[model samples]
Target: MTAWTMSDTGRSAAGGLPAGETAAQLVHRRLRDDIVSMRRRPGDVIFEKEIALEARVSRTPVREALLRLADEKLIEIVPKSGTMVARIPAEILPEIIVARAALEAVTVRAAAESARGSDIAGLRAIIERQRETLATGDIDGFHATDEVMHRAIAEAGRLPGLWSMIVQIKVQLDRYRRLTLPQPHRMERALAEHEAIIDAIAGRDAETAAAAMDRHLDGLRVSLAPIRDLNPDYFSGDVGAVYDRWAGEMA
Candidate 1:
């Protein structure tokens, strides 16, 4: 029998849940992080009973959390077949990149116009943290800092809503990206691209910042083909299958 409790996590520690966080909310956050970070893994079986036992929570909250994740498409619950983490959607990746690149360019341009010296410094700090994570070969840690770098630019522009929207749309992209990070010189190249964006923003060059952001995001769109070829099972089938699944859901 497992003796560990949910309090072991920082947010829901023995001290108590943060503000309005319920057990369901806490469970949802943990499971979502596991899914997005690829700790749970694509197509891996996810038993609610096991998760509830590990969290020491009642099945009600666990059910609620799983339902929420299903809504996010992080986990797909099949009729009579149980649930598994959703595979990355290769067909929609480029569409997502196009949308994200446009929105991100807006944010970086705004950041160039509005960012103070302190904001630039904060972004530099995040990149520096990424530098450390890369040196240690810590892919997840490096990716977390990469998120901070992008979100920092959005926040620096006072457009946190844009970042919030991006977060919602990027979870699928993230699963694919985590795979890309392990490729040769990938993390190093990403760090360099981040530096270029910061330089443009620090110089208060909005056009240059947007262009740099474009080049940065475009790299992912370009990497999709090679990475998908290498990890075919990690992605869903081509457009027809992807459309069928989504269409069935909406029916």
Candidate 2:
């Protein structure tokens, strides 16, 4: 188990946030959101003092948050090099996404077969919340609800290990998911996908549920297709070029 160094309560001392906000919490939220939302691009170095100044908080919380981010494999802490954002091997990401599709297919199938009336109700509630979030155009709320919806399916399957593994893998591709959402109709498409999967699971149609989940994962490739063409310079290293070469070879 990776030790989370920041104690639940000890995380608050570094910055002077409002009366209700602790420095640690503020730092953690800011850094985590920045990384997930791709605002802190991969390979960006985060200086505690700079973040503290920007956040209007103290260095303590920022340090604690950095520690936590390191644990999550979202950042690297080097004694002499400072803290750098994590840069996953972009070329291998496609393979990882394929693995994710396989795992989710199994998980959703199991969930569909095992889900009870109560479980179906729970999933419905999450869908309702997602609809509300969409109606309000609350990206954060929709993101949070998306998590709840996915977890609910895993829980219904009674597979904690599978759920944990999927989460770990999904986090690796989260940068893509975050970026995909900003594209036109991405949110609407995602909502439709979610509805299809949830409906299948609710109906206890294991095959249908698994197929829906697979389709959802496959959509990722479609989303990434245009990105590679429009922003070739933005992606670093040979990763982007390599992918382009792979496509040419396949063709």
Candidate 3:
């Protein structure tokens, strides 16, 4: 895990405070970013006083921040003991994957029908940028650029709203996907998959583009067993919460 310091805690997510953003919000963003990026690994203890001191704020705001993180399940708050970073709820990942794949496949299919020369050019440009970023060993930048590729595809398909929906559903999945970056050839294979999808879209083959996209997204689903096995500590053992959440969604 990457180490963060007290000095790093004072700054808000974007270098400075945005209008009306409070101390608690800033601290929450800092902690959330650290947790999601695996800088603060699963089961790492988080103390209110330490966080308060780091942010140069009273414990009230820090406590509030921690509570918010708990609500997101990014951190677990133990009433008597202490708070700790939450493990990945591996149970929910399959459902998340299914939702994303279904949505993205539709978007890619639509993009194949709607794609213009400019759209194709823009996607190719993103691919070039991803390649350049990956070459520099900036895996995070490469992954970010890869997301732009998906967003561009959604926009090209005239279904930009669906991309926002995708973003909303991907919060937990993002943390899991971040772990996949350093795996040998993971990023390369993803890039190749993107290329295949773009090729099909460029050819105006809607069905082929959708199939390529399904295959691309399915890669993450297939990765679960190996990734979970390799990093058992990173995942939650109890899957009941996932089943409960799904049932609640239906009700």
Which candidate's TM-score is highest? 1
Query: How high is the CA lDDT of each candidate model?
Result: 0.84, 0.75, 0.84
TM-score of 2: 0.75
Clashing pairs in 2: 14-58, 15-58
Model 2's alpha-carbon lDDT is: 0.75
Off by over 4 Å in 2: 1-30, 43-45, 52-73, 76-88, 230-234, 241-251
> Comparing candidate 1 with candidate 2, which one achieves the higher lDDT?
1
| TM-score head-to-head 2 vs 3, winner | 3
- Report backbone clashes per prediction: 0, 2, 0
lDDT of 1 by residue, 1-251 (tens): 12235455444445466577787987898888888787878889888898877777788999999999999888999989999999987777766777899899999999999999999999999988999999999998999899989999999998999999998888888888888899999999999999999999999999999999998887886676677678777888684455455445434
Model 2's C-alpha root-mean-square deviation from the true structure amounts to 5.9
lDDT of 1: 0.84
RMSD (CA, Å), each prediction = 5.1, 5.9, 4.8
* lDDT of model 2, residue 234: 35
lDDT of 2 by residue, 159-237 (tens): 7678788777776577667666667777777899999999999888999999898888777766665765554543545
Runs with alpha carbons beyond 4 Å of true place in candidate 3: 1-16, 238-251
